[model samples]
Target: MAHIETPTDEEDITDPVEAKKVLRKVDWRIIPLLQFLYMLTFLDRVNIGNARLWNLERDLKMSGYDYNVVVLIFYVPYIILELPSNYFFNRIEPRKFMGVIVMGWGLTVTFSGFSTSFGGLLVGRIFIGIFEAGMFPGCMYLISGWYRRHELVTRMAFFFVANDIAGTISGLLGAGLGSLDGARGYSGWRWIFFIEGAVTCIAAVLAWFYVPPFPENSNFLTPAEKKWLLNRLKSDNKGMSHEKMTIRKVADSLKDWKVLTSGVLYLAVCTTAYAISVFQPTILRTFGWDDLKSNLLSAPPRLASGIVSVLIGIWSDRIQRRGVFCLGGFSLSMLGLFLIAFLKGSLRYMGIYFAAIGIYIVQPLCIAWCANQVTSSAKRGTITAFAGTLGQFGGIISALVFPSKDGPQYLPGIMTCVAFQIAGVIAAINLWVCLSYENRQREAGKRDHLRELSQEEQDQLGEKHPDFRYTV
Candidate 1:
């Protein structure tokens, strides 16, 4: 039902400068607003991790294993509804559809503030996951509609930085709000959910008017500008087709191995990334710090994650490489995972937390890198959503694996993260090798159908036009 306007058969033409000129004609007003909305989307999901050490555990009377269980409840519906939600996202206007989703999850998050028992917490989180799952992939699809192929990495990087900024803001906000314990009798953890969720609700209300539906719908651009934008897209790949069904859309999508590969690597990244986000506060407590201090100190490592994620994303776009950056990121994370697995004393444990910070920087790079490799707009949307939705399974597993009893070192969780990092590295390498082989075949005039380009695409990429190169 989602209709993204792509170029029609009659509009297929080839002039690079004219295409670029056409792109300039479209409006730009809504871009900043959409980016901010997603930053809040990502931030709200992870802030529960920040609340772990504050008052969440005590209020729930969580046993040795309850922490991970709480997070696992979130992934159940989150995984099931991703593709369907995205398909609808394309059909409905983002201004309305994404606005509804944001508000739905914001209310769920706010309701969590009132939960007195773990059962109530699980119910709130499940709905949060269900609604929030619509955000990122829909945005990726939206971005593809706005920017051309060559311009994607930089734009994706800019959009992704909001996710990192949310992490930083979570820390800063956690520090200020954690001070609210016993203020008007509300606990520190409850305050976190209440305030952040309220902000999300307000942002959701605003998004209804702020997010542009498509080029044609954008009042910021003249009618001439909308046609120009449509033509630019036609040049890329026969433009948009919204008549596709969700099942057929997915079936067509599976023909590309990039989806499977990206999903696996993202799964691994999620493993290591969630380990840090979900457990870092608990890890901090292993040091000599008490509850408040542990919560306060946890902020720095996440802040460090924010700083490093932007630096790496910018560096990646500049260098235009994927495998090496992705591998290096997993390597840093693996080192951090192992350090915690093997070491023990408080000071030594603090050092392990720093390694955790360094590891998280790799995730956004891998996502941006993988996103660049996928071409078709609809296919790209499915893959991005699939990758993220599947990756959260790591969150589900960790909820059961790391208990309060495993605290102080959480050796098993550390080992699992390290092992998954190795898996992530292999997935990245495989992606590089497969794409490299295809790149070579195109050079040799032997473009086969085994994940190689079809003849129509071969012609477009044959010249290796400055506009056409693999995302890596």
Candidate 2:
């Protein structure tokens, strides 16, 4: 068992100065390393869309549906492996597990560069999805372990900014790599894979040594610091127990209605996010811009979204609220997508900026919102994976909606995103209602049965414990 040292007083344990010091250390040590890893993951996943502008489909003799099929295949392995990988992530030391995942995906991405036919590229994408299955969910689980619920959104935002940066830089990188066209007899698209994958591979090797595990086992902290950190989190919720995860626990965690609702909410958002990330470059090219100019134009919208994500995260944490921010973000996405679906020319270009801002900001908030509601470590892992696994189907939805048949307008795809954005808003409101009602019930002493249970039993009950109040 890990050592647990109790401070003589709660005030000493939560001293503002000491808490700030630890927060800064964790932000610097933990967040930066994970940020780099997630950025690489996003780069490899969405760069296929970037490849399209450079004649990747024509070079490989791929039909329009064939391209969609290739994109679709990635989600198969990604969804199937997410839950099991997260389960194992908690069982194994995170450094080894996450390192192996990063390296596996990096290798697969590099191999994708060597594909001579559509079949080879298909196989590479499948493996890339499998290897990447655990990264985002695992990162969420890991971040939850370090920070309290109120402090979580900002940290998650910092981590999520990597996704926006990846989207923005994919454009810049795709443009620069275009210069490498015909070098070593490979197209610019191939060099995008080769160079980015090589860098990911190097970063993965370093992550094994750098990425810290749960706070209790972290090597960078002193023994007293580790105990203090653990105690501080435990006081926030008793369900953060050291007990080993079990099959029953995993099943029970999945049975929560909130998990399903959260999954649906995220599913609605993911379609919009993946669509924007994967196809925004192609969308820009339709405006009479050449390959380089389209890629350059793609950067600003995502850059705006990234900057706003940090600000929203800080605001969410400051006010200790999440659902309203999510609702507002999705509303922005709805307006943006509606504009894109109906408008043309310069006005439509303005829609892209609005859509970009709305699409990217909601995702991190949703993840952080879900993370705050769960109490147990194992349950947190399970729900994050469950939500992620369900949300990944949105990628498939995106692939199917935007066939090349739609061309420059892509009205069906754009409207599909608009409809989902409305659904996401509704789901956010519903979650807020249910959570608030539950908190009221707890305040009214409706969970008196919790008083009869021992500490271990109360811990096992997780969010069901009477003292546990859901974050709205």
Candidate 3:
């Protein structure tokens, strides 16, 4: 093992005021660009739901389960590519790599507008998935590198607020663009793809210029600020931040029980979220709302979800507890799903608000919770990507559950989401108990036997180091 030197106390930011200033500076520089990039990413991915309202299925001659297949195919490459993409993110300049991938997806989305057949659209979706695989997990990995563990959820909440905002924007844009039904001979659905995709390409150019490198190499930060930030992170992570990427580190992250459980937690939230993002318009239509009205109505639930997510993030970070918030959020989502499945009329529609808020809240909390447990940058990236890969299964499941045949109540799909939320609640409770127990054991010096190991071996222990405590 290669040992890295730890930052001295002299390099640490001891003054609370100065520390806050540095954090705020980092927040403004990185978070907004990440928010914009991710927002566009989400808008491009889920706008297809909106497009369905504008006759995409009819225009392309899609029938039966063809639309579902289009949704399902995107996740195949998406799930397969995430781990490798994160692996490459570690080895490449993040801005350059992210810029390239964003451009790739943007172009795919733009050209997808021109598709004349189901096969053409399917091919476009696959390419979009391939290009977009790295984005969310990559953002999570980058955010973890910049902020302390306790500060993480709030920042990630803001990041995911972009996701909710994108959901809102997708609905609004769909309504706005769908009205263009024919402009220069293109249908309103094509306009959605063309306009959004073009904007993404433009954003991609800006991303190449603005997205900051990791703290260690960030040019925007003064050397003193960099030193302080690095020292703070090193102390927070017990010097585990100094570890290099290695095969063993990767393998260790893959096998970690905590990482796997976190994935289950994430999966439950994502399953419901993905279902709503892709099918909310259709679901609303079943409630007797016209297509445009359905598109317009979808905005409020997502907007409400964004607000609740930010509030929960602030509260979770202040309390510095992850599991309790996750449990609350998951329970709220289950309640919403239950209402949506069982109720009728306006009551059923109101359930969407609860589901949206709950799912969005749990999504970021689970991501930050998972990232909080791992100390090594390499392992953090790998584990975040791994957990994220598992979560994408929700997208696949979402596609299958809400088939057109099941619409006008979609009881089976709604119930399926409810089941996953219950699973999420259980997973969250189990992880909390396990992590809290390990933390107590570490505090009691039960892991002190490892102190006799060589310096390199001790460093290699990463989160398992006796002095390291997990955030539950």
Candidate 4:
């Protein structure tokens, strides 16, 4: 394949595909800061789980399904605002938008620690929802803006590791902090909220200072390095040039069946993922361990999930295939669910925790895959947000299953999660098979349109060749 060099503004670039490749290059200097920013995002979002293990509800006198209700409140404004949040991310400056989100959520996380009543906690969680809601999709939008579709899976896994790894940290911290339940007149669960929430505010301060804007607007990159970046993207075909998307454009981008399928696939994974995220520590409590031990035990499964995520990401990239990883990983996650569902308390089933690792794989890979599937870069960003937001609808449903009264044994919730993981696997297979068949047909020289037609006859083909991808 012939590559096109990045053209200067002074020149007219030929081969739009080659020009597009020039736009996908990443700035290495900024990635580490972004990773930490995402780390903070995950930490603040999942710390509520740690609070659960620390006996937060019991301390506050939350009963019945009240705990679940508190957790569910965060997702309300979160899901409702995602589309506009992402649109704001792209339209406004990401560095500014993202920093504000980080700082705002940090405040909410801190206030959550001081809530003395259900109404107060409800208010805190709602603030958390409003603040943290835009941070993720905004950050993801920033990431895809910086890197090309192909280079993103492993990187997204690294970024998402922040979530699982944050889970581990929350577990470890929750355990240690619960040991301080009676210290300084503060309950251990309250301290967990106080400490973690405060840390997020501090991290938000750091994000304000460190998280840079899009590369084209970056100060760190030399003029020459920026040129190198542009040229490199011109070598990949996914456009990253200066272009903005309009509302009508976003709607038009949804015309493909692939968009609908990708949304469903991700929703399935989110159902299981969110189910486990908020409830994992509580689930471990059923093993007859007390608050501290249960919180500590929650760390291992998350660490296991993080470790396997990196390996699966590398393997998925190495194999140069996205769909295989999505299907295989979800299958393993489902298997883990089955083991936990049936074996209950057996040593033979201990590996169920390790199998949870597979669930982590689909998130990063499938996210990267779907973002790559669309042709228009602006359209791609909106689709990514749409898929993520739609997927979060699972959170609403998953939260309803883990009742506080079901304590010491939440089998119904775990089984519910298992069913969703299987559903994701099936959806992934549907997408994989569809894309594979499309590729084969193109290889066989079947144009779908009449081959005998003149170039002008197939107007809708626009510049898109069959090489266009689908998210597995």
TM-score for each model:
0.84, 0.95, 0.96, 0.88
Residue-level lDDT of model 3, residues 1-472, one tens digit each, is 4543433444666666767877899999999999999999899999999999998998999999999999999999999998888888888898999999999999999999999999999999999999999998899889989988999999999999988899898999999998999889989999999999999999999889888888989998767778888888888887466445676777877888887887898789889999999999999999988998999999999999999899999999999999999998988888888888888889999899989998999999998998899888988888788878988999999999999898788999998899889999998888899999999998888999999999988987888899988888
lDDT of 4 by residue, 142-219 (tens): 777666556678778887888787878877887787678889987887887777777777777677766767667766
Q: If the candidates were sorted by their TM-score against the true structure, best first, what order would they fall in? A: 3, 2, 4, 1
lDDT of each: 0.70, 0.85, 0.89, 0.72
Q: Candidate 1 on 31-132: residue-level lDDT in tens?
A: 567678888887777778777757788988876556677787888888888778778886798889988999999999888999998888888988998998
In terms of TM-score, which candidate is strongest?
A: 3
Candidate 3 whole-model C-alpha lDDT, 0 to 1: 0.89
The stretch of ten residues in a row with the least summed lDDT in candidate 1 is: 459-468
lDDT of 2 by residue, 1-472 (tens): 5544434442344555666676688789999999999999999999998887676777788885988988889999999999888788888888899899999999999879888889989999999999999998888888988888888889988898998899899999989986688898888889888988999999988788888888878888766567778888888874766555677888987888777776888798889889988888888888888999989888888899999989999999999999888988898888888777778888888898888788677888888788788787877887788889988999999999998789789999988888788888888898999999988988988888788988777767777788888888
Best by lDDT: 3
The runs of at least 3 residues in candidate 2 whose Cα sits more than 4 Å from the true structure, single-residue gaps closed, are 1-15, 454-456
- Among all windows of 10 consecutive residues in model 3, the one with the lowest summed lDDT is 1-10
Clashing pairs in 1: 1-91, 2-90, 2-91, 3-91, 6-240, 7-239, 64-404, 68-399
Q: What is the C-alpha RMSD of each candidate to the true structure, in Å?
A: 6.1, 3.9, 4.7, 4.9
